[model samples]
Target: MLKWLRPLVLLLLIGLLGIFGLRWTQQNMRNAIPSANSRVSPIILVPGSSATQERFDAMVNELNNKTKTTSSLLKVTVHTDNHLSYSGTFEPGRSHPYIVIAFENNDDGYSNIKKQAAWFNHAMTILSTRYHFNHFSAIGHSNGGLVLTRYLEKYFNQQKMRINTLMTIASPYNFSETNIDKRTQMLTDLIHDNKKIPSNLVMYSVAGTENYNNDGTVPFASVEAGKYIFQKQAKNYTQITVTGEDTTHHDLPQNGEIVSLIQQYVLHISDTKQRPDVNVRH
Candidate 1:
């Protein structure tokens, strides 16, 4: 009986020690890599004016396929919606290295920028507040680029929202009719203003030239306007021109070659190849 008691006591002590060791190992791992819930910067994908949500879907899938990650393209169908707005999992979170939110406005994020920006404002504010996102990366195409510019003018550098990098694909910043408004004026003004906007922001203005020297939609100059607008801060400015094939203004989001350039700028892929058409003046 005494022999049995001693063995049982030894077994109990070993079990307790195993539990303690396991806990210690978990704590050490937690301290090293940080937790899964640790905050990460979000990438916001905005479609061009009058563009459909489906337009970005293939691109999103492509990004996932290329990176071998499960990063999701979160859809906010309505600007007024909040965290409860969309439903989906992190898709096993196995490949998800970061978060991507693709914003789709009911009004198509065009027609009227001031109003469209309002939707971006409401949605981003709620997301930042809810998720505690401190920094962001922005990508916009066509008039969607204008929306990002407006969003920065309103929210960036504020206590709530901040952006690190901005990419505008075939954006017509020189569109004649938009400058009459005060907000548009402010966007350009802020860029050139001496008060100084955030020094951390790096902007890429990407243009496309098709068969006829035009992007089949937006003129080459219109896309290049960003270089001038952000000229004073040249270090923060980059102008990229993707020419050839179906690399039209509308085809930019889907073009693999151009998307690789985007990967070079944003995702920082391993590709050593660089296209001559891309005039990266960073």
Candidate 2:
């Protein structure tokens, strides 16, 4: 008789969990980004395969501190492990320039991009719920770009997550020819499926070379390969290649030169028009 009661109690616990899950989903959806189409979209920075969120601290400072730059139009509020949401305003039309969501992927997504990208999708959901942002712009360094690229392929249209711009810094898309997760071909496949990619999605491949050829870690050719693919996909693919001592693979996110260029060149939100004549082919 006691064993029979156990099943009944287990059923009640399961029902409670289901109800809680549904409540959480509803609240998350309701608080996502607004849909006005004219506000400054949130900017998201995702680090590379083994890096942490601290990688962008210097760059984030540069962006927030710039006095007369396009990137300055947004006030960067980095979301850390302890803090889940911005302490300030998430609204766009007001005093805030832009809300930057810089998060760390605990997994770093080193091995499998598909699984990694799925995790990325979930992170975005949490951000959406927290900030209630309507649209967003994305920046990824190294393999982090692969995760975002795959996420777009699978879930971009599912919830109308408007990604107006995507910027990849020193990412090695074609690192291996025979690896199970052909990171290079993933972008190629994305380009092949360009029609599905939103026209408003402008992608920039920012490559840096420490020496004369490679950016310490990623090859110049690998980053530039997306030039045509973004063009074909109507993502307005732009390739920026910079030669300098400070622009290493790891430093690309924090390099002052590259950061200034991005501020003047790639960053285009409702407040600022796209800066012109920087190797853009769209």
Candidate 3:
């Protein structure tokens, strides 16, 4: 009886040690990872074809130049050679930072857009690990919007991070077609793949009109085609048409009114209330 009791006590002590060791290991691992408060939620931007990460510099300047509070800017370019180059730094403790991602082969065409989507995913994996964010907002201009849409459908992993809002500026979802009745192959594919888009996302599609029917580069009909892709899929979808002196396709990104729209819709500002007197068409 004494021998049996001594063996039982030894086994109990070993089990206790194992339990405490696991607890300690778990605690240390949790401590190593940054808490949600410590992590930053970023607004990521992607430029159109032929534009680099610096494409948004003027817009960022316009954003920071205002009397309103400013967030830091960080530019990251993923080269075709499988290396990343970064510029700028995040403002300390800034919960909403701006991160612009551009590719080395920023070419036009559908095939290239697909490759950019893949590259965008690779860049995101590294960025997510570095920033430790569980969510983000996205802004894409022109072809960049297509890239983001493709990424969301094919490569985005919601288990890692969620996308809350997506704003597409002057994206020709149907390419240069002026009639929504005529859908391009790209638009058809995007429509078919719409189910993969997150249902809780809030989407804003902004179309710039330099004339009655177009933004001087992309047709208004082409931009409006985004409705087919996001209207029913996203939780909330709003289409805004900005018409003014600088509402051209290239100028839309830096347009003063567009900048204000970004501040009101995209950023984590103190005042997010909508103005009653906005002149833009909805």
Clashes of each: 1, 8, 0
Q: Write the per-residue lDDT of candidate 3 for residues 138-182, one digit (tens) a residue.
A: 999999999999999888766556887899999999999998999
Stronger candidate by lDDT (1 vs 3): 3
Cα error of candidate 3 at position 73, Å: 0.9
TM-score, candidate number 3: 0.81
What is the RMSD of candidate 1?
13.0
Query: What's the residue-level lDDT of 1 in candidate 3?
Result: 94
Model 1, range 9-98, lDDT digits (tens) per residue?
A: 999999999999999998887544222332556677777766755556777677767766667566654443433355443332343233
At residue 138, what lDDT does model 1 achieve? Answer: 78
| Top candidate by lDDT | 3
lDDT of 2 by residue, 97-189 (tens): 444433443444335666666656666776666556657777888877766776777666534467777888877666533232345546566
The lowest-lDDT stretch of 10 consecutive residues in candidate 1 is 90-99
Segments in model 1 whose C-alpha atoms lie over 4 Å from true places: 1-38, 80-84, 87-111, 176-196, 272-282
lDDT of 2 at 278: 83
In model 1, the Cα lDDT at residue 108 comes to 37
